[model samples]
Target: MVDESMRAALRALPKAELHLHIEGTLEPELALELAERNGVMLPWTSLDELKRQYAFENLQSFLDLYYQLMAVLKTADDFRDLMLAYLKRAAADGVRHAEIFFDPQVHLGNGLDLDTVMDGLLEGLRLGRERYGIGGGLILCIVRDLPVESARHVLELAAPRAADLIGIGLDSAEVGYPPSLFADVFVRARELGLHCVAPAGEEGPAAYVTEALDLLHAERIDHGVHAADDPAVTRRLAEEHIPLTCCPLSNRRLQVVHDLRDLPLRKLIEAGVTVTVNSDDPAYFGGYIGANYEALAEIGFTYDELKALAADSIRASFLPEADKRALLG
Candidate 1:
């Protein structure tokens, strides 16, 4: 639906990605390559077959394949290669800053230690900054369906390294697990001065959004697409200026929103809510940050809307005020 000029402009805009899962950037080529190197046998025969398997019935369905893909990523070099590949694509797509999420439970459950994961990823990130000039930050997220004690243990593992890990987040299946379940862990994260965020309304109800802000004290809401269903909740979020990181393509892929028409971005923006577009799981979601913007453009976003969305991303990021202003400028 977007014209050539509009697509060009969207590509040229400098943007920040705030909701990316690093593991989710595992492209088809890299996934298979890693599988070969690590001696892990996958169910699919060819990469095209693997791509076809990305179709999801729901969040849990996607998580099943997502975890299976992790079996190929066993060593430090595999992690480094994964992040490096994403950064290369990000730099080309005009992503100036990226706040990346990593699920430690997935890696640790696969017998990879936090240190190995962090060291490899941080090395790639540092190299990306120097080689590609891409700014980056790390966020450690807990799988919501997992036990509360597991979330706490992950927090403890990350607390001492809070300087390296900038934020704490909750992801995975959001329907059954509510933010209130991790109240103690979120509290501890805040007490330690780490930024907090959670995906509240992807599959969760509007009340779960309220619990995220009130009980978990989350600074931002990720994939809060359903907040539009509640006027009172929508008004509060708009008035308070809490940012919602909305992923259009991801929603379509996960069946959260039936189609691009189901996206509430324009409505959210019109109602004065700060909604920023992101690619939640780029590999699974079928694009990176730029593709998310392009998808919105095809759905009828103007140049100004693109600028506003980019600005929202800046405001939504946990970067220092000066850094944000620099990016905004």
Candidate 2:
């Protein structure tokens, strides 16, 4: 078990959160509050009903509820409130910097314009910096399960707001839709001067990681636990100094592994892979970045090892070198 001293240490350690989904930060209380404020009707009448649904069987099951809860976020204030709340929680968890993901495609499908999402998020980032002294930026994620043309359309829509985004990422269901399918989309995103990252080797095979690196030119791999399944791929990740943002709680909550001990974090770290811990969807997965570090401690990571993971997180983030150096110190 993690002692209070260790928990305090974990909370005090400065770190960067690289694989967070902003929409996934919607807690049940906030969801209900937004729903009622927006006059939107939800299937669950009470918080208990919503909390009970958090027991997900897999990624798809969790995603179904994830998208459903997004119905409450209708206005710019809702989005801004969402960002501020997440930053507040993340700040207390020792997050000095955060590169958060937002699914614009789903919001567009919800009859909202891109400006509502971008403006609100940007404003929230500005306020978060003032209030919590936390630096952050947005990563516009392409929902892979959607049509390829939809992906292309969102990029076109985001072109004007390119300056607001730090990167573009591919997320959503991973099994059937591979990274290769979105090569053109990523190519366009790169042309717009956006860094590329993708969710691979989560519910997909290790080969998807290779495809993401080769075809999509991904700079970072999110939830890349399965890369440990292939020695060659593992070697490539280590040799190239590519980073994997591993989320222990999300993996276990989604049943990617039946237990936290079954995760390949230690194997990847031992293989010289730059492994950094993150909270993928904290509100849904049951923790923030700090909780993830504590879970690693429970699974046998030493204090020095945890500190190394924190350093790796700062290195893997999209922050400027000077800012990273300041945080590292």
Candidate 3:
């Protein structure tokens, strides 16, 4: 077990959260509050009932509940409150910077305009920076399970506010919807001067990692644990210095690995791959970024090794070079 002193030390390290989903940070208490405020009818009556559905057998199971809970977010204040709440928790977890993810298409489908979503999230970011000094931007993630045309449409709608985003990412169900499917969408995003990142090899094959790099021009691979399955793919990641944003607790909670010991974090590190720890969906997965570091420590990562992971997180972030150097020092 990790001691209090060690946990305190881990929490003191300045880090950047690279794979967070703002919607996934909704806590049960806040969810109920928003439901009441927005007058949205949820199937679950009490916070206890809502909390019970956090158990998941797979990615789809989690997403089903994830999208359902989004109904409470009907106004600008709701979105702003959600982001501010996440930033507050992230600040306590030593998040010096955070490139947050938000699904605009999903919000749009809920009868909200793009302006409302962007305005609220940007306002939240402004407030977060003022309050906590945490600096970062958003990565508008494309829901891969939806129609490719919908993916294209969101990119089109996002073009006007491209400057507000740090990057574009491919997320949601990863198996059948390969990176190759959104090749055009990513190309357009690049034209808008956006960085690229995609979730590959969590539930998909290691080949999906290659496709993300080659086709989508992904700068980082999210949940790339499966890349270790192929030496060639792993070698490319190491040689290219492409980072993997691995969420240990999320992997275990989602049954991506039956046990935390089964995660390939050590193997990936030894192979020269740049791996950083993060809390993909902290609230649902049961930990924040600090908890991820502590879990690694519990599994035998040394103090210096954990520190190195913290440095990796800052290095892998989308922060400006000078800003990154300042944090690294």
Candidate 4:
């Protein structure tokens, strides 16, 4: 149960979720529902068994199961239900705004078109605004482990609908497909009016963070926990006010860091780098945005620090300036 003191604090605060993956929000119950509706056969018969698989030796292990679950999501309605479920939980956790990521490669591999995925996601987001009053945006991320040509094709598709697609990001594994591999794709994305962001410093080195900024022109860095490795890069990021969307639990779960307290979060903040805590994948990573805050707070961040983190999330988001001000104010 949520503690009374923490519950009050969590409810009253306005939060912006900066690093969630829309597909990663697929809870087991909804997975079953979608599977049944689509007549898809899942390998697991029960939710308990599915939850057990969440334990991971590394990022690759978890990704295998993550991709396996995608088989159940094949239609527009499945995507809508996936997003609507996340929105409901996020609203309950006081998420005022969210910049959600979705991998088009995964959906397209399942024979789903970009329009189908966008239609469902946008429909759910519209319903979220009307019903839950949540402000949110979409970031179509490229699965970097795939061919660069695939990323280019996705970017080409996103260019025409650039208004709906606010940003482009790099997700999937970070070790092999470093930020430099997607240099051309990110350049085109930025030219087409899409903000560029990428996940580095999880399993990758500090060099990847530098490449994300220099080569990919990433506006923000996701999972930048290892920036502390290089004093010069850390100072440069801080000096430029580049925000780092740090996912505390995802770091711990993926073995990016030993523990929450062991994380360089407080250090990153102290170093002048803007840091925002987020639930990278609520269902797969174990909690929602409020749970992420609660986990960090338990490790001893002060109320003012929590507020700063919340504000940083909004500042790093792609929300319209007016909406950003309203959320922060």
Candidate 5:
């Protein structure tokens, strides 16, 4: 069991969230509200019914439900309200800084325009900073399941509002769609001076993580727990101090690990890699970043270990070092 002291320690430390999906923050209650507002009829009529569906057999199982709920997100207010709601929860959980991932390609597939998605999320991020004092930015994702031209089109749209977005990422199904598929996408984003990160080695192989680092030149790896599967890559990640954004709760919900104790935090840490805990999808997988820390504590994480993870979080973030130090203080 996690003691109150361990929980308290985690709550007191301000940390950065580096692996969150903005859409994954959509709670069942908020989903229902948005559905009603947008005049959409959801298959799950009640909140409890939707909650029951949150349990997933695997990553794709969860993605199906996650994308289905997003049908209600038709207006800018829906998106802004969604962001504010998540920022409030994150702030309450002691998130002082965050880099949120958004799937604009998925939104576009839903027949939503680029401006509506970007404008509302940027507005909500602005409000999150003003209202919650939570420093944040957006990283638009390229869905690997889509064609390269679709991603290129999304990038073109991103160019106009490049100032509002800080980075580009590859998300959605990772099995067949390798990081190498988006190599040129990252090259263009890097040329435009946007930070790059990729979700790899979670459901895919550790080699994919190396591909992301070597080919895509991703600054950080999201849900990189499976990188522990490769000794050489793991060692290099340790020696090079590559940050692996680990999401424990999401791993369990997605059946990445059958047991919370088997989450591989210790192995990654022992290998000398800078591992930071985050809530990939709070509402669906259950719990925010604080609860992720508490889960680690329950599995034998000490106060110092928790502190180090918190520190690693800020260091891995896109924030300036001076700002990082201030947040650290």
Candidate 6:
């Protein structure tokens, strides 16, 4: 069993939460409250029924409920409240910086303007930096399952907010909709001076990892666990020093790994891949950044190894070099 000192140390490690989805932070309790306030109807009558949906067998299973729950977030205030709640929770977990992910496509489908989504989230971010001292940037992610044309539209729609948007990312289903499908838009995003990141190899193959690297030109891979399935891909990632934001508990909950002990975190680290622990969708998976490090600990990682992962996270963050050096100090 882990000791109290270790637990306290885990809570105190200054880290960066790089893969969080703002929408995924919606707790079931908050979901209900927002539903009532927005006059939005959630089909589930009891909280227990809603909680039951957390048993997601795979990525698609969780996404179905994720999109559904987002119906409650209708206004700027709701978005501000959601981001503030996540920031406070992360701050308590010792997160000094966070590169949050936001999906504007979902809100667009709900008939909301892009300005409402960006303005509300930016306000919350401004307040978060003031109140919590959590410094970070936002990566606008385009849903892969949607049309390439739609992705292009989002990039155009997001133009006015370019200064606030640090990067562009590709997320959502990865199976049939390959990273190559979004190549044009990703190139367009880079031309606009945004960093590139993409979700690859979680449900896709090692080839998909390569596609993300070569085609979409993703600087970092989110949920890149499937790279473990191929030695060559792992070697390339290690040699290139590419960072993989592996969401351990999220992988387990989604049945990506049947046992935490079987996770390839140690192997990836040993192979020289810069691996970082993160909460992909904390509310949907189980916990936040602190909870993720704890889950990885369940497999018997030592203190030094855990600290190394936290440091890797800082290095992998998009923070200015000066800020990153300060954090490292």
Q: Provide TM-scores for the models.
A: 0.96, 0.98, 0.98, 0.97, 0.97, 0.97
lDDT of 2 by residue, 293-322 (tens): 999999899999999999899999988899
Consecutive 10-residue window with the lowest summed lDDT within model 3: 54-63
User: What TM-score should be assigned to candidate 5?
Assistant: 0.97
How much does candidate 3 score in TM-score? Answer: 0.98
Model 3: per-residue Cα lDDT over 59-151, one tens digit each: 778888899999899988998899999999889989999998999999999999988988898899899999988777999999998999998
Best-performing candidate as measured by lDDT = 2
Model 6 has a clash total of 0
| Residue ranges of candidate 5 with Cα displaced over 4 Å | none
Steric clash pairs (candidate 4): none
Q: Give all candidates' CA lDDT scores.
A: 0.87, 0.94, 0.92, 0.86, 0.89, 0.89
Cα misplacement distance, residue 53 of candidate 1 (Å): 2.1
Candidate 6 or 2, higher TM-score: 2
In lDDT terms, how accurate is model 4? 0.86
lDDT order of candidates, best first? 2, 3, 5, 6, 1, 4
Ten residues in sequence with the least summed lDDT for candidate 5: 54-63
Q: After superposition, how far is residue 266 of candidate 5 from its true place, in Å?
A: 1.4
Cα displacement (angstroms), candidate 6, residue 215, comes to: 0.9
Off by over 4 Å in 3: none
